[model samples]
Target: MQAYRIDGVVRQGKTNQDFCIDLVAENEDQVREKVYSNFGSRHGAKRRYITINSITTIDPSESSAPVVVSHFRDK
Candidate 1:
């Protein structure tokens, strides 16, 4: 399985008024889908949260390392 990094101002069991979105997705369409899915759906059908932040796309520097980093951040 592959992992993707998502960065957003997640509201714990609530909605963020001044929300923002920023993160890396599998593709262009996945970007909107991911955000909507995560924000709209409840976590484990219990906790609800909204990602009000930006997500950054991260790629592995090397294959051996499992570390993922991106220059995705608020300016």
Candidate 2:
């Protein structure tokens, strides 16, 4: 598994909110899909309403997320 930092905006009504999240995935494509699915289910935002600004690969040692930390720690 790889850790990724995804930065983007999610459309909510007339405004867009900035979001930066970390996720574990095999590749960028999977990460992108996860973002859309997550926002869709959690925030009621559609795929078209999400804009991905950047996708950065994060070194395991640099990740502060507990999910990322625990995942790599257990490996």
Candidate 3:
């Protein structure tokens, strides 16, 4: 697993940082297992304001570098 530093601006230009997680497993099942075992809480009780910072891969065939995937605000 790897951690990414997600920097963004909130309302009123307040800076915030979020920890974006990325990992590669042997298969889809392993990915699910890891995410569930570790990030199930964050996934289950969705609070919004979640965002992705980057998604770099160890493989060299990627066309572009990792970028933001999504962003939201908690109500």
Off by over 4 Å in 1: 1-4, 13-25, 44-49, 60-75
TM-score between model 3 and native: 0.29
Q: Which run of 10 residues does model 3 get worst, by summed lDDT? A: 66-75
Clashes per candidate (backbone, < 3 Å): 11, 0, 0
**Compared with the true structure, what per-residue lDDT tens digits does model 1 show for residues 1-75?**
122445555554455444444444557457757666756674432224443345444444322322223332221
For candidate 3, write residues 1-75 as lDDT tens digits. Answer: 322232222221244444444454455445445444543364342223333333344432221223212211110
Backbone clashes in model 3, listed as residue pairs: none
For each candidate, what TM-score against the reference? 0.35, 0.91, 0.29
Give the range of the ten consecutive residues with the poorest summed lDDT in model 2.
66-75
RMSD of each: 8.8, 1.1, 13.0
Q: How do these models rank on TM-score, best leading?
A: 2, 1, 3
TM-score of 1: 0.35
Residue lDDT tens for model 2, 1-75: 899999999999999899999989999999999999999999999999999999999898887888789889966
**Order of the predicted models by lDDT, top scorer first:** 2, 1, 3
The C-alpha stretches of model 2 lying farther than 4 A from their native spots are none
Query: Cα deviation in Å at residue 9, candidate 2?
Result: 0.6
